[model samples]
Structure formats: structure tokens, C-alpha cells
Target: MTKNKAVFIDRDGVINEVLTKRVKFVNKPNDLFYLDKVPEAIGLLSSADYLIFVVTNQGGVGLGYMTEEQLEKIHKKMKIDLESEGGEIQDIASCIHKPNEGCSCRKPEAGMILKLAEQYKIDIDKSYMIGDRDVDIEAGRKAGCSTIFIGKEDNTVDANFSFPTLYAAANWLKSTSNL
Candidate 1:
């Protein structure tokens, strides 16, 4: 069977706003605030036949800021909200370990992406990882996928491309011949 192509997206700061000062993590459903046009971006990517997966690092669970059940509830709400907006999420892979836990599934590590690629029969070479941090870009590179940084142009992170938002990235991907 032919392998599928995918787009791995980071949850916080990419799909949802990360209130750095007010709230460190989205521990509850009410804390979850989506970034502008995120669902539309996901829908656009889906239209391009790119399976979308949210790969997030939710260390707050390990830190006791929230429980696994609460995380589930938040994800459920997120899924419903996106689906209602014509966007689709194939799955969500999260690393619940603490920052120094040294887990393999966290951002900057290829474990999550690799496992998902295997599970979904995905072709990493044709896949892309869109995120807002250096770790996310590093993870995608380690996983053998193109990386798209969703933030201001920063030389610190070596992303293949940088965009202001997911929607902008989606548009570029749709028009790019490289993909």
C-alpha cells in the first residue's frame, strides 16, 4: 500500500493562543482559546490531502497542573470545535512528561512523529511539521519531515519556512510546488 502524507501541528501557540503570563498551560476547556483562522487552515490542509495530527507537549499533566481526564475533555472540545468549522484532526499525540523527564515522545524528539508515521503508514519525506518553537522544528527535522515555523523570522530555529500564522502557512503550502 502507498504511504500517506501528513502535517504534524503543535497545539499551544499554533492552534491555540498561549497566554504566557496569565496561564502557562491550557488545563481546562475554558482555557483553550484558538488562534485566528486555525480551523480554516486545518481545513485547507485537509483539502490538500494532508493528514493533520496535533503533536503537543503538555508537561502540565506531569506537573500536576491538570489530570489526564481533563486533557481528554479539552481535546474532545477542541475536536468538536474544529469539526464544526470544517477542519479535521486525524489524531493527537502528546508528551505528558515533565521538561526534564527525558521522555522520547516530547518535542525536539522524533519519537512521537516516528510512531505516528509508522502507525499511519506515513511517508515522512512528504510530510511537514508546523509549529511555533525551535523544538518543534528540530523534532520534524529529526523525523525526516519538512518544518514550517509559525512565528516571526528567527535565525535561532532552522525551519524550512516561517509564517505569521497557520493560515498563511497553509496558503503557501497549497501554492508551493515543492510539496
Candidate 2:
């Protein structure tokens, strides 16, 4: 059987704006404002025929700032919006455990990605993980996928590629023949 190639993306900072001032996390559906060209970026990747999975760490749930139902509602709205804009997500996996919980599914850990890959028969070597933080890259590296960092030049994390925005990364992925 042929394995699928996927892009596992981080939620906050990468898909939506992280409002550090307004709230540390997107506790409500209304608080989930997307970044520029996010829909377009996802659409581009979708058009390229790569499966998309959102792997997020919603620590706010464990911190008592939000409930799982609220997180579901927020994700529902996100999916509706992205679908309306021509992008499709295969699934979303989130680790609601706090940072100190040391959960296997959280970022900086490969559990989430590994589980998704197994469930979907994804080719980790051919897949990619995109995020704005170092932990995301670390997780991707651990999972044996190519990592893409979407942020300012950070010398700390060793990502396969770096871009300033999701759109830029999508463009590169679309143009790349290796995928």
C-alpha cells in the first residue's frame, strides 16, 4: 500500500495570531483570529495533494483557562472557515496537558506525530512539520519528518527550512520536487 505524505502544523503562532497581551491562549472561539493568508496557505498545500494534520498543544485546558468543549468549538469554527476558504484538514490532535505534565503527545515529544502517522499510514520521511517555535521543530525531528520553522531566523533549532509566514512555506513546498 502506498503511504500518504502529510504536513503536521502547529496551531497558535503558525495558524492563528498568538495574542500574548489579550490572553495567553485562545480560550474562546472568538479569540481564534487567524494570521495573514492562512487559509490561502492551507489551500495551496491542499492543492498540492498533501494530507494536512493540525497538531497543537492546548495547555490552557489543563491550566483551567478553558474547557475541552470550548476548544472543540474553536476548532470547529477554524475548520468551517478553512473549508469555506478551500482548505481541508485530515484531522487535528492536541495535547491538553500542561507543560510540566510531561505528556507523550505534547510538542517537544513525538507521540502526537507518531500516532497520526500510524493511524493515517503517513510516510514520516516524506512528511513535514511546520511551526513557529523550537519545540515544534524538535518534535518533528524526533518524528523523523522534515521540519519547517515559521519565524524570525532562530539559530537554536535546526529546521530543514525556515520561512517568515505559512504562505511562504506553502509556496516553497509546492515548488519543491522532493515532496
Model 1 scores a TM of 0.95
Screening candidate 2 with a backbone cut-off below 3 angstroms (N, C-alpha, C), the clashing residue pairs are none
lDDT of 1 at 126: 89
lDDT of each: 0.90, 0.91
Give one clash count per candidate, in the order shown.
0, 0
Output the TM-score of candidate 2.
0.95
Worst ten-residue run, lDDT, model 1?
170-179
* TM-scores, each model vs. reference: 0.95, 0.95
lDDT of 2 by residue, 1-179 (tens): 98999999999999998866754668888888788899999998998888999999999899998999999999998988876668899999999998879789999999999999999999998899999999999999999999999988989978999999999999999888353
Estimate the Cα RMSD of every predicted model relative to the unseen true structure.
1.6, 1.4
What does the lDDT read for residue 78 in candidate 2?
Answer: 90
Model 2 CA deviation exceeding 4 Å by range: 20-24, 177-179
lDDT of 2 at 30: 84
Highest lDDT: give the candidate number.
Answer: 2
